[model samples]
Target: MLLRKPAASELSAEPILSAAENYSGEMHAIDTGVRVDAVEFARGRVALGRLLAKRGIGYGDRVVMAVANGPLFAAALCAVLARGASPLILHAKTPAAEMRRYAERYAARMVFGDGSSETEYRETGLEPYLVEAADWARLLCANVKIVDESAGNVSLVLPGVPLHPTSGTTGQPKVALRPGRPAIAEAAHYIETTGIQASDTILVAAPQSHAYCYGMGTMVPLLCGASIITMRGFEAGLVQSALRDTNVTVVPAVPAMLGSLMFGTRGDLFARVNTVFSAGAPLNEKTAKAFANKFGIAVRPLYGTTETGGIAISLPGSQAVAGICVGPAMKDVEVDVRDDGQGLAPGLGMTYVRSESMMTGYLDENGLDQSFVVDGWFKTGDIANQDTEGRIYLHGRQSEVINVAGMKVIPSEVENVLLRISGVIEAKVYSREHRTGSQSVQAAVVAHGVDDADVRAHCEKNLVYYKRPSMISFVEALPRNATGKIDMAALSNL
Candidate 1:
């Protein structure tokens, strides 16, 4: 009942599909050198949907797509959903074997992959349909792809939703099922809150597979009749060039990507860009301030999880509260904190959120995992505090909290102290377990001129005995996943 049926003359025209047909601007895939206007995008999706339906991807069928951020991803998503099939997205760089493993594990009916991964899919008996940006020009314009015009124009019936895999910062990734109407509602909320206009152009450097980028980077822009240019992956040089060449008005990125772009730049590059959204990971004070100082625009913090499409975002021109605020709850979203007695600040506690856009439940081996929800609220497993004006200040995830003999050490608090030390570029604080079954605080730092002793001296002066790092290792860089969150598993091995 949420999505009204489109007219018989229209092709799969729902909210996002309808917007694609009505809007006129182009969506570009920089790596593939492909660009198409809204009408072309809509037609391409319809054609692709028919192809998928013919391939036996219909109601209740789940298809796994290992496509990157580009026109192919956007068009393919609409196509799969329009066919009443669930689509599971994986990172483009995900290996062929891993892609096949996920497909088999998730019981996917088929797979859709790029040219590079097609052979692996076929070898694994996945029978993947190869989707290429190079083929898009022909696919979008060629009427031959759609055998029956009337069948293509028939109403798009939805019987399945999209599936998203959690970032798995703490452990193995979990599959999340998000209902169709709620996901669309979340996209509409984001468009209204961000004030996205029909003329605005968004540069989506983040991978489209992630829920945050899928909404802000793709769906919100399309639904608002705005243009979007997508990159296969995050690259500082290509992003800078895109900014210089394209009329980009908005940029949606993670904290690490924003931090990387702060160097070797003049204020003029982002002169036309009005909004820069930082999510996926914590937005440090240094990165936010340096970006604002260089470009005259502050990086707005957007807080969300794979389980929830988007929760809160800092409003335009809002000041950061101690350089750690995610402004306020999104429209129709409820956010609150609960005391877990884990030794946080006075008001800080475990963060909980409930929203219309929240996933139905986590997909597990047995079936769905609704145990994560209490009443109607989803426990976010984040340590945070909310002010009277309703802004949320995040410390870090509860799982990331390092407990030193009953004393809790928040990683962000220690990382912030390290950043204050001169020459320290990046820092990650984690717990190291000893042979005696006790956890000790360990810090890994990336710095230009600072050494272990200097870091030790600074921490001794600023932090309590238990909160200070027992071991410090200097590294050239921190290992981060595709979404820019520190790969804790990789860090532990280091």
Candidate 2:
């Protein structure tokens, strides 16, 4: 399933904006029904690009887009890319402090924001392209022609730079950057891997700032000529309404959002959603099974990183299985398991990747370097075993692996078994050093009507004695980060 690289000229000339031209003339986007066309989209982007250029934005300059999901956000991003400047998109809901740090770290020259964000930027003495009130109409109606000559070079000067954040519950999130070649390759791989087509209508509920939303939610749909339904934010009711209203066929969401749609909302939220892809964190088998049983549709668990792009490994709707075996490597990508920094036999040790879509490097105060790889393969911190069939089963991060009496215990393995208990909602297991100079496993669980005895009994049936938790702590709910991943650092403090 190797994807031959298409020439840059062919890709650039391809009608990415044709959906707005040839498709439905009156389509509902956000709160308005607007007719779209390639010409109009082109015109809008040119107008915005010209404005950005006049404001001193040039090729290779970083323009931070801190806007919400909508037509403007899409147009602005495409405009920036088309004009030869790199757009550094940040989640609109990201904390002001974090956003400021990203802008400073990247040395972004200008920022595009809505009214609320404009206020925040103003206090920081930064100029913001505030797209609210009269400015919105002015910017969109500028009528500047986008000159094709300014498309600039496809190759980036910095090549790979951290464009998105990883789900870090330990401390400040780690950012990974994929270069142009790998980024485009990964985007294409995701579309091919999922069998996404021009006819598929994708419902994007994740924030446009996140990689899942930005790549799958925006880039793939455009590249594949699929219609995208963008939501301002995730509300269980809004998701249900959009599912029915838009005839959305495919949905990519985090587990937290899926859990809410499956149990929090009643009356056929999944009725129109044929394929549901869940990622960003591990999905427990119980939740996956329950969703499938209730919705009569498979909940496909996907695995990847911002550095890697969308769904590197995923089960298709037809081959979906319960729990987290994130299928196999996508087309044009390779996955290997390693032990002691050497490639291991199939189905054992740490997972390593060598793919067209892998990130180039990480950029920080110290500048960028190829941080996570040895030779050519990028060592994914995740520990896993791949079956002969090539299905990958994740066993948690290597940093989190516990050594109990010299035998390694992966916390996710224990937590998976614990989550299957009747009343257990969420569980986290980790290793702690004991006074006796041995490492012992501790479990933190969020349950309803399930006590330590019940959880212990459940684990006893599924796990070996050496893998069982030495102690269990109960919490009303597990703390999660902004991306809805469990906050392990916060949990450690608890």
Task: Please give, for residues 92-163, the per-residue lDDT of candidate 2 as tens digits.
Answer: 665444555665556555556542454565565544453322223233111112222222221224311225
Expressed as tens digits, the lDDT of each residue in 1-494 for candidate 1 is 11233232221225555555566668887767788877677778778887777667787566777677888788888787787777778887776667656666666656665634445555555444443333672221100122222331123232556778884334567887676555666788788788888899999899888888888887777667788888888988888888998999999888889878877766789998999998888787777877888888988889888777789999887655425688898888888899977778788898888887776666655455666666768888889988888889889888888878988889889998998998988888999988988899989999998888999999999999999999898898889998888888888887
Candidates' lDDT values, in order?
A: 0.75, 0.64
The most accurate candidate by lDDT is: 1
Worst 10 residues of 2 by lDDT: 140-149
Q: List the residue pairs that clash in candidate 1.
A: none
- Write out the backbone clash pairs for model 2: 20-36, 20-37, 21-37, 347-386
lDDT of 1 at 326: 88
Flag regions of model 2 displaced more than 4 Å.
Answer: 1-40, 127-162, 167-174, 264-269, 317-321, 341-347, 431-440, 457-466
